[model samples]
Target: MKLIETIPENFEVQIQKITGDNFLKEKLESLGLYKGIKIKIIKNNKVDPLLVKVDNRRVSISKGLGLKIFVELL
Candidate 1:
Protein backbone atom coordinates (compact mmCIF):
# COMPACT_ATOMS: atom_id res chain seq x y z
CA MET A 1 0.00 0.00 0.00
CA LYS A 2 1.08 3.55 -0.57
CA LEU A 3 2.20 5.60 2.40
CA ILE A 4 -0.31 8.38 1.79
CA GLU A 5 -3.26 6.00 2.09
CA THR A 6 -2.68 5.57 5.82
CA ILE A 7 -5.04 7.34 8.23
CA PRO A 8 -3.73 10.23 10.21
CA GLU A 9 -2.98 10.12 14.00
CA ASN A 10 -1.34 7.29 15.96
CA PHE A 11 -0.15 5.57 12.81
CA GLU A 12 2.74 3.13 12.71
CA VAL A 13 4.29 1.06 9.95
CA GLN A 14 7.68 -0.26 8.96
CA ILE A 15 9.19 1.21 5.90
CA GLN A 16 9.47 -1.11 2.92
CA LYS A 17 13.02 -2.41 2.91
CA ILE A 18 14.82 -0.98 -0.06
CA THR A 19 18.28 -1.55 -1.48
CA GLY A 20 20.12 1.38 -2.93
CA ASP A 21 23.43 3.17 -2.92
CA ASN A 22 24.78 4.34 0.41
CA PHE A 23 24.16 7.92 -0.51
CA LEU A 24 20.50 7.24 -1.21
CA LYS A 25 19.93 5.36 2.05
CA GLU A 26 21.60 8.11 4.04
CA LYS A 27 19.48 10.68 2.27
CA LEU A 28 16.31 8.82 3.09
CA GLU A 29 17.34 8.36 6.71
CA SER A 30 18.01 12.05 6.95
CA LEU A 31 14.37 12.56 5.98
CA GLY A 32 13.34 10.48 9.04
CA LEU A 33 12.70 7.11 7.37
CA TYR A 34 14.18 3.90 8.71
CA LYS A 35 13.30 0.22 8.84
CA GLY A 36 11.41 0.27 12.15
CA ILE A 37 10.29 3.89 12.53
CA LYS A 38 6.66 4.87 12.04
CA ILE A 39 5.64 7.94 10.11
CA LYS A 40 2.41 9.87 9.82
CA ILE A 41 1.07 11.51 6.73
CA ILE A 42 -0.12 14.66 8.41
CA LYS A 43 -1.43 16.44 5.33
CA ASN A 44 -1.48 16.21 1.58
CA ASN A 45 0.12 18.73 -0.72
CA LYS A 46 -0.80 17.81 -4.25
CA VAL A 47 0.73 20.67 -6.18
CA ASP A 48 3.48 21.52 -3.75
CA PRO A 49 5.32 19.11 -1.38
CA LEU A 50 3.87 16.20 0.56
CA LEU A 51 4.00 17.04 4.27
CA VAL A 52 4.55 14.27 6.82
CA LYS A 53 5.26 13.96 10.54
CA VAL A 54 8.02 11.77 11.89
CA ASP A 55 9.50 11.69 15.39
CA ASN A 56 7.12 14.55 16.20
CA ARG A 57 8.69 16.75 13.54
CA ARG A 58 7.13 17.74 10.24
CA VAL A 59 8.99 16.65 7.13
CA SER A 60 8.22 16.96 3.46
CA ILE A 61 8.22 13.92 1.21
CA SER A 62 8.97 14.43 -2.42
CA LYS A 63 7.00 12.71 -5.15
CA GLY A 64 9.79 10.28 -5.98
CA LEU A 65 10.34 9.21 -2.39
CA GLY A 66 6.61 8.93 -1.75
CA LEU A 67 6.25 6.43 -4.56
CA LYS A 68 9.11 4.29 -3.30
CA ILE A 69 7.80 4.11 0.28
CA PHE A 70 5.32 1.26 0.53
CA VAL A 71 3.50 0.99 3.86
CA GLU A 72 0.54 -0.89 5.28
CA LEU A 73 -2.08 0.85 7.40
CA LEU A 74 -1.97 -0.36 10.96
Candidate 2:
Protein backbone atom coordinates (compact mmCIF):
# COMPACT_ATOMS: atom_id res chain seq x y z
CA MET A 1 0.00 0.00 0.00
CA LYS A 2 2.90 2.30 -0.48
CA LEU A 3 2.22 5.69 -2.00
CA ILE A 4 4.43 4.83 -4.94
CA GLU A 5 2.27 1.77 -5.52
CA THR A 6 -0.74 3.97 -5.90
CA ILE A 7 -1.70 4.93 -9.43
CA PRO A 8 -0.03 7.79 -11.22
CA GLU A 9 -2.95 10.01 -10.27
CA ASN A 10 -6.37 10.01 -8.57
CA PHE A 11 -5.75 8.51 -5.12
CA GLU A 12 -5.94 9.57 -1.53
CA VAL A 13 -4.05 7.76 1.19
CA GLN A 14 -2.87 7.93 4.75
CA ILE A 15 0.84 7.77 5.27
CA GLN A 16 1.61 4.49 7.02
CA LYS A 17 5.36 4.45 6.89
CA ILE A 18 8.28 6.62 5.85
CA THR A 19 11.81 5.39 5.35
CA GLY A 20 15.15 6.49 3.96
CA ASP A 21 16.21 10.07 3.29
CA ASN A 22 16.24 11.50 6.79
CA PHE A 23 16.33 15.12 5.65
CA LEU A 24 13.49 14.58 3.25
CA LYS A 25 11.44 12.84 5.91
CA GLU A 26 11.69 15.82 8.21
CA LYS A 27 10.83 18.18 5.40
CA LEU A 28 7.79 16.13 4.45
CA GLU A 29 6.53 16.15 8.02
CA SER A 30 6.98 19.87 8.20
CA LEU A 31 4.88 20.11 5.08
CA GLY A 32 2.09 18.10 6.75
CA LEU A 33 2.99 14.53 5.90
CA TYR A 34 2.03 13.12 9.29
CA LYS A 35 0.56 9.62 9.75
CA GLY A 36 -3.11 10.58 9.76
CA ILE A 37 -2.99 13.24 7.13
CA LYS A 38 -4.54 12.33 3.81
CA ILE A 39 -2.53 12.97 0.66
CA LYS A 40 -3.28 12.81 -3.02
CA ILE A 41 -0.80 12.30 -5.76
CA ILE A 42 -1.65 15.05 -8.21
CA LYS A 43 0.97 14.24 -10.73
CA ASN A 44 4.53 13.15 -11.23
CA ASN A 45 6.48 15.77 -13.07
CA LYS A 46 8.69 13.39 -14.98
CA VAL A 47 11.30 16.00 -15.50
CA ASP A 48 11.23 17.15 -11.90
CA PRO A 49 9.63 16.40 -8.53
CA LEU A 50 6.30 14.77 -7.71
CA LEU A 51 3.42 17.04 -6.86
CA VAL A 52 0.96 16.13 -4.09
CA LYS A 53 -1.89 17.71 -2.22
CA VAL A 54 -1.80 18.01 1.55
CA ASP A 55 -4.32 19.95 3.61
CA ASN A 56 -5.58 21.58 0.45
CA ARG A 57 -2.13 22.79 -0.42
CA ARG A 58 0.20 21.54 -3.11
CA VAL A 59 3.65 20.37 -2.14
CA SER A 60 6.47 19.06 -4.24
CA ILE A 61 8.24 15.93 -3.08
CA SER A 62 11.51 14.69 -4.35
CA LYS A 63 11.55 11.38 -6.19
CA GLY A 64 13.78 9.80 -3.56
CA LEU A 65 11.44 10.64 -0.71
CA GLY A 66 8.35 9.66 -2.63
CA LEU A 67 9.76 6.21 -3.12
CA LYS A 68 10.07 5.59 0.59
CA ILE A 69 6.63 6.56 1.83
CA PHE A 70 4.12 3.75 2.26
CA VAL A 71 0.48 4.75 2.14
CA GLU A 72 -2.85 3.02 2.49
CA LEU A 73 -5.34 4.19 -0.09
CA LEU A 74 -8.56 5.49 1.33
- Candidate 2, run of 10 with poorest lDDT: 1-10
Residue-level lDDT of model 2, residues 1-74, one tens digit each, is 66554447767778888887678778888989877788888886556677889979998877766778888888
**All candidates: TM-score:** 0.66, 0.80
Q: Output candidate 2 Cα RMSD.
A: 1.9
User: Which portions of model 2 show Cα errors greater than 4 Å?
Assistant: 45-47
lDDT of 1 by residue, 1-74 (tens): 55553435456655666445677778878877776677777665555566767788887776665655666665
CA RMSD per model (angstroms): 3.1, 1.9
Cα deviation at 42, candidate 2, in Å, is 0.6
lDDT over C-alpha atoms for residue 62 of model 2: 73
lDDT (C-alpha, whole model) for all candidates:
0.65, 0.77
